[model samples]
Target chain A: DVKVTQSSRYLVKRTGEKVFLECVQDMDHENMFWYRQDPGLGLRLIYFSYDVKMKEKGDIPEGYSVSREKKERFSLILESASTNQTSMYLCATTAGPYNEQFFGPGTRLTVL
Target chain B: AQSVTQPDIHITVSEGASLELRCNYSYGATPYLFWYVQSPGQGLQLLLKYFSGDTLVQGIKGFEAEFKRSQSSFNLRKPSVHWSDAAEYFCASGYFGNEKLTFGTGTRLTIIP
Candidate 1:
């Protein structure tokens, strides 16, 4: 089974603070993705990394950046957290575009 | 652009009752369709997927879905509902070999005794 683990399950940060959400996959998948889930809006992609040091912006990538220094780890960074940035962050990894993605438990971020 | 739509926002069913969830997708060519269930505080789990071939697909936990090309729909169904089946279900669509998938808003399922 593919195991995807996130660094935190819940986090709280003050406005303008920097925040980082880390995700690691044991399967060494080549594709990693970051998504924010909101009520009535479903899961919206924030960023994705196809390979180490290669990143692409998703539909809603504003105020967010991603790092993929290694094949097993992917990190999502918020330049300066704002209240609007509060959301449930999900990380997923897949072997390829056509494969099913395995997801982490997700981190519920609260930016106050 | 590919998109998915789930008409029902929420549905309630008694235990042992039948269940069905509607899902529709808009895409130019043949698309990959998936049904995912997310339990409370858990990540999404793949219930089933529709790529090609057979229109009816069986999935885990007694769940199945049918793909109708004429209707552009992939609706999920279950013979009987269980308490554990209460969760949020999402329908997603994307082209084969595409990295991004368009997901529906999700339908929250509630099972009653």
Candidate 2:
């Protein structure tokens, strides 16, 4: 079975603070994604990495960035946390384009 | 662009009753369809997927989905509902080799006793 683990299940940060959400996959998937889920809005992609040091912006990439220094780890960074940035963040990984993605538990971020 | 749509936002069903969740898709060619379930405070889990061959596909947790090319629909169905079935269901679509999937807003299911 594939396992995806997030660094934190819940996090709280003050306004203008920097926030980092980490995700690691044991399957060594080539594609990693970051998404933020909100009520009635579904899951919106924030960023995705196809390979190490290669990143692509998704639909809602503003205020968010990503890093993929290694094959197993992907990190999401918030330059300046704000209340509007509070949402449930999810990380998913897939071995190939046609394969289904495996997801981590998710991190509920609260920016105050 | 490939996209998926779930018309119902919320659905309520009694335990042991039949359940169905609607999903539709728009794509240029044959698309990959998927149904995912997300429990409270949990990440999404793939319930089933429809790529090709059979139009009707069986999924885990006693769930199934049928793809209707004529209607551009891939609706999920379950014979009986359980209390543990309460969760948010999302419908998504993607291309053959596309890495990104277009997800529907999602339908939240509530199982009533």
Candidate 3:
């Protein structure tokens, strides 16, 4: 089965702390995405990487950054955590457009 | 810009009752529509998708959805609901194949036995 693995399932951080959430996929898919799931907001795109070292800002990329140093690994970085940034972050990978994405279990972040 | 709308924020139904979840979308071209279900604390799972061919599409877990081009709607339905079917259902649409998906606010379903 294809799996998108997230390194952390939960994390707690203080304001102004840098936090990293890692994701890896075994499918060799060319596209990887980061989204934050919130109540009444659904899942909003934060960042996505098409290929190694190539990234694009999504609708809510203001407080987030991404790293795609390897083909199978993608990382979402929080420059400085804030209370408003607390949410469930999901990572997904897919081969091409409009196709099914394999998503990781998600990481629930709490900022104090 | 392409967008999707799911008006119902929460829905409740009995285990043996029929179910229908509405979804609406706006896009310039022929859009790619999809339904995904997410259990509590879990990742989203694809329930069905419409890429063309037939307007009515069947999916796993006995869920089905019909696409109506005139109304720009893709509504999901099930003949009978099960207790385990309670979850958050999301409807999404995008113009590009294999590209980023723009999802709706999502509708949470609750099954009462």
Candidate 4:
């Protein structure tokens, strides 16, 4: 079974604070993704990494950045958090573009 | 632009009753389809996927979905509903060999006693 784990399940931060959400996968997948989920909006992609140091912006990449220094870990960074940035963050990894993606448990961020 | 639509936002069913959730997609090419379930406060879990060969696909937790090419629909079903099955279900679609997926608004399933 594939396992994807996140650094935190819930977090609270003040406005203008820098926040980091980490994800690690044990399956050695080559593709990693970050998404923010909201009611009515569903899951919107923020960024994705196809390989180490290679990143691509998804539909909603504003206010967010990503780091993939290693194959097993992917990090999402909010350079300066705002109240509007509060959301349920999800991380996923897949072996390839066409393969099934396994997701982490998610991090619910609250930017006050 | 390619998109996924899940018409019903919420559905209620009694325990032991049969279940079905509707999904439709608009894409130019033959699409890769998927059904995912998200438990409260958890990440999305893959229920099933439809690539090409089989229109009828079975998934975890006694769930199944069928793909209809003419209607551009991929509907999920279950023979019996359990209280544990209550969750938000999402329908997603992507082009072949593309990692990006467009998801529907999701259907929140409520199981009645």
Question: Number of the top candidate by DockQ?
Answer: 2
lDDT of each: 0.93, 0.94, 0.93, 0.93
Sorting all predicted structures by DockQ, with the top scorer first, yields 2, 1, 3, 4
TM-score of chain A by itself in each prediction: 0.97, 0.98, 0.96, 0.97
Between prediction 2 and prediction 4, which has the larger lDDT? 2
DockQ of each: 0.70, 0.75, 0.68, 0.66
Candidate 4, residues A7-87, lDDT tens digits: the string is 999999999999999999998889999999999888998999998999999999999999999999999999999999999
Give the alpha carbon lDDT tens digit for every residue of A1-112 in model 2: 9999999999999999999999999997999999999999999999999999999999999999899999999999999999999999999998576858889999999999
TM-scores of the candidates in the order shown = 0.98, 0.99, 0.97, 0.97
Interface RMSD of 3: 1.7
Model with the higher TM-score, candidate 2 or 3: 2
Candidate 1 TM-score, C-alpha based: 0.98
Better of 1 and 2 by DockQ: 2
Going through the candidates in order, the fraction of native interface contacts each one reproduces equals 0.52, 0.60, 0.62, 0.52
lDDT of 4 by residue, B1-113 (tens): 88999999899999999999999999978898999999999999999998889889999999999999999999999999999999999999988678778889899999999
| Worst 10-residue lDDT window, candidate 2 chain B | B93-102
Clashes of 3: 6
Error of 2 at A77 (Å): 0.1
Error of 3 at A8 (Å): 1.3
* Residues B1-113 of candidate 1: C-alpha lDDT, one tens digit per residue: 77899999999999999999999999979898899999999999989988889999999999999999999999999999999999999999878778778899999999999
Tens-place lDDT digits, model 3, residues B1-113 = 88899999999999999999999999978898989999999989989999989999999999999999999999999999999999999998877654788899999999998
